[model samples]
Target: MKVRELREHAKELDFTPQEQVRWLAPRQLARTAVKAVLAAVFAGYSDKREVQEVLDADLLEAPCGQPDAREIWIDYVADVGDGFDATSSVAWTLAEEELLVPRAIEGTDASPAVGDLRLRRGSLLVLGGDEVYPAASATAYEDRMKGPYRAALPKAADPPLMVALPGNHDWYDGLTAFLRMFTQQRPIGGWQTRQTRSYFCVRLPERWWLVGLDSQLGSYFDDPQLRYFEKHLSANLEPGDGVIVCSAEPTWLESVETNADAFNALHWFDRNMIRTRAVPGSKRRVPTHASVRLWLTGDHHHYARYAERLPGDPPGTGVPAPDSRRRQMVTSGMGGAYLAATHRLPAVLPLPPPGSRLREKDPPVAFARMGRTYPDAEESRRLARGIAVPWSGRWLPWRNLGFAKLAAGLHAGLFLLLCFLFALAEGVLRPVDAVRRAGLDDFWGFGAVCLGVAAALFVLGFLGRLLRRILRRLRRRRGAAPPSGPEVATARTALPPSGPAVATLSQALVALAALAITVAIPFPPSWDGWLVLLLCLALAAFLGAFVGSGVFALWVLSAKGGQVAEWQMSGQSIEDHKGFLRLRIAPGGDLTLYPLVLKTICRDWELRDEPSGGKRPVPTGKPAVRLIEDPVVISRGA
Candidate 1:
């Protein structure tokens, strides 16, 4: 979640036709109910069996150590994110004073008291979330929290089993940052946390097994959670024991289905009954379970307890609520976040509990401008809302000050800034509509991704050319054969190569095409006049095929280029060296070479002809093939 910090002022919510009718339906003792909940999570969280990490004496010494402080560092939270900005600023302001932050879970004098709830026989304390606000490293765990209330919870409380799943926010830039502070194995002075966010199955003292899914992948890989569920649930459920799935981004919110539309199709909670198949636990070899029992989540920063009856799910709703117990969904994310409420959509009734009517408010209602023939006004616009918004009846002032004002308008704001900058650019020079119809701007965001790929390829080409030249010069100095033929191979001792002669060739080709297109015809202003999309692809491919190939071939094997010997000829002294070139020996003893980087790349000039999968003619003795390197040297040089 990004940050949004404006002072919270009291304003009445807009009354929906139903709300107007239900206003006197009694505030349902909402204040009392909410307090009851806050108390439960705070006090009861400890009854679970989660063991806090005992850090090395040196790890925390440099930062928080005081002469009398204990060497073992435990509870403080660590946030690693880029410092303040619009997003970070919001996170900081909102974070400074509310919600959950691993604060002690004790009882309050007002209501159900903190120490009231109990776990289901045995349960793990699961943190399926982005526990801190804004995720900025500068915002320490304490910067935006109200924990003293929970700190009052006594030590007699039992802690739940600790099973944590990282969220998109937890992974500010990359996951290693948060992992370094909490979950991973860190040396005394390691920079980032070295932990794996793989799914974890926690075993309960009873027979329960709780699975924590790391949904952080939603930002990295498509369908990450779905894929993980598919892979493990088929084999992880147990019969006598119950199953609990905890994740950030509760599946239910997929409730108001956008795009393809299925109320909860994308939420795993919505799909659980379909995922669990009969399988034994990895360690306990028992016919544990074929179906799961519960789903708990946080991320939608309010309390949401949803109940649903999928067509075939068995009823597991505990007693009083027999019809809704089997499938329980809870969003305890009230842990910490600036709270927002959802707009009551016009035609919809409250989805009914355990599905509640609370969440961040809906987006704005845009107005379309009336044509010239009519009154000068705007109305009836089709608008899509954003993540957070003002309560239905409220309107926030859009100002430009750093603290409370928003410089832009409801929507035109972000883009007008760009248009203004462009006008300046053209005013200082000539009109240029590069972003019009025919230019690369016509493509969706894909342009940015493709450009990144092209940049990486170009850099590789540049470095390969540089290294190849260096090797060629070295061979000349050693009175050896110049390096040649797609990077350096074992044969490099007898061969050398010539790097690409034209460095600006691709750019030049693009420039000529753009020049021709600009002068040849008068196209529509809507048409962005440019062909860099296709042109860039062609050049990038050329680079990958030719220049890229040589660069790839040089790193697959641990061998030097030209007169330089990359690997120890035959000795163990080469332990620290990396293999730059790949050595492939086919069934017929033909060898192939490839270069190694993020992935393997084949050299165009050094293709090794190999036998296919079909049978190969061979003698049935001594493994039949003798593969050898050139000039096998002494053990010391291996």
Candidate 2:
């Protein structure tokens, strides 16, 4: 049976704690983490693509849409489904804006013949990946992903086409729910779904193609997926054809620290499937090649574009090349997830990092980032301090209630552990008087706990210092510039060498202060004493949310590492800097990309009752949306 239409009788969705997926919540964190592990283990045993192949349900030859349509507009977004405020805000913006005309199309050449460019609502909506947060399920898709979209555009006669690529979160259930929602050729709200497989190829007008690849969890592609692409390209693709490859992850950006499985796979696909024509049963290529013009992805949760190094241009210059059709790697994952730090984006990205498979014919090319980032580097560094520094501007304890609770729980657990250790040391065995007696004897038990925590902090600080040193040496060896940005601005001060040392000392002091608060509670056997313990626990929880989070931030700053920098901002639950891509493929086969970004999501939503048993969200405060930069245009040159 077809899934019932959500728009007809849609119920109002509460965007509060009940509906939103708090990523760091204890239960949610444990469940998703365990499911991720199980999914990985079971993935090799059961491949969904292979199952489709066995059942002969593959959509390789499925009619995607009309291939001869001259002009088209597409809305592409990824990494969605966190909070309703963010998700619904994005959906509302897309739905409300019937036509988007940029304030000024400034980058192109000034010509009277060039008419004003108008971007209408995309007939095709491409959801790049991670449609829901934490995990994928029927309820998750309905509540977190599909429902918001339906409410945004409740009904439409000429509905837009929707296609999706599953990100890591979507694979937690082995893609069971993903296949059900996306591959069924059913209508989701006013949008129509036509893709018959997780991965698909859609030919556009003027010899341009949109290829969505499913690199399942950034691992190897199934044989069927690879063969499907290879066979399709060999049959339909011709020399000089332009291809826009959409993937779930931006492996090139991640290839720096992560294992090269995904990047290597993409490189192989680019070399064999798209770039070169292969001889039968041979690892050779013909001289004729299709132009793999743009690699569009969304794993990083930010907007960044990297263009191939031109012949005479210097590195790290954010200037657009004269030839717009050159290979450009763009990451636009800012659909509706927590904002990621943009300060750590490398000025220049080398295509194949060391240890990854090198390109067979061409040497490793340095791809320079073409323009400004979404939050911009300075703003990202500034935003990070609120999380890294205690009591900073953005460091309100209530920002992430889930993390605050988790922190409190941890501190409470620690208190219990200390009580157990104290009881073990003493001759007391009865559980009835354990807490009352633990602190009655002496301060030794509490003192020991403080010492242990301080010792751990010192150790962590030492390791961070060591890691920083290793990184500095590596940068010197590679002749790369040292890490800059506001977070590291303290290092350039007069006390440069003492930066990490001071940070370590401060962290130890904060830990002692947090522990001392709990130690101050007297252990009288009266009911009043238990009440005092409860008060002390509350204080401890506050300290955990405040100073505990700061300790982690200090460690990240001291380490001065990109991976740690990313972690520092992970739990913030920031609902700003959200973005998506609006792409226009003209009749002449020119691709114009508008990278639109919204600075802050609308928070106050008014719930209005709908006739279809659904509630619609109307924001009192309009979102501040703007283009990230001038539109990126890729022309089909003669």
Q: Provide C-alpha RMSD values for all models, in order.
A: 31.1, 6.9
Tens digit of per-residue lDDT, candidate 1, span 1-638? 11121111101111000000010011322432443344344423421111221222111111111323211111111121112121122222122221221112111123333532211211122345664444413223322221111111112132212334665555443444444444553321112122234345443322333566554434222243344444544344444444455665644344332211222232333234333342335432333333344455655432333433444543333221223223444444433232212221111111211222321222211111111100001110100011112231111111101111111121123232332333343343222343232233332233344346556776787789789888878878988443232111123232223222232333323333332243234455554424533333343344333332222222212222322221111111101111111122222212222211111111111111223322111111111111111111101000
Candidate 1 weakest lDDT stretch, 10 residues: 15-24
Quantify all predictions' global Cα lDDT against the true fold.
0.29, 0.69
Q: Which pairs of residues have clashing backbones in candidate 2?
A: 9-612, 10-614
Report the lDDT tens digits of candidate 2 across residue range 402-500.
666666677666655554554565566632244455453355555666567767876787788789999889878888454343222121232244455
Q: Assess candidate 1 and give its TM-score to the true structure.
A: 0.33
lDDT of 2 at 344: 65
Best by TM-score: 2
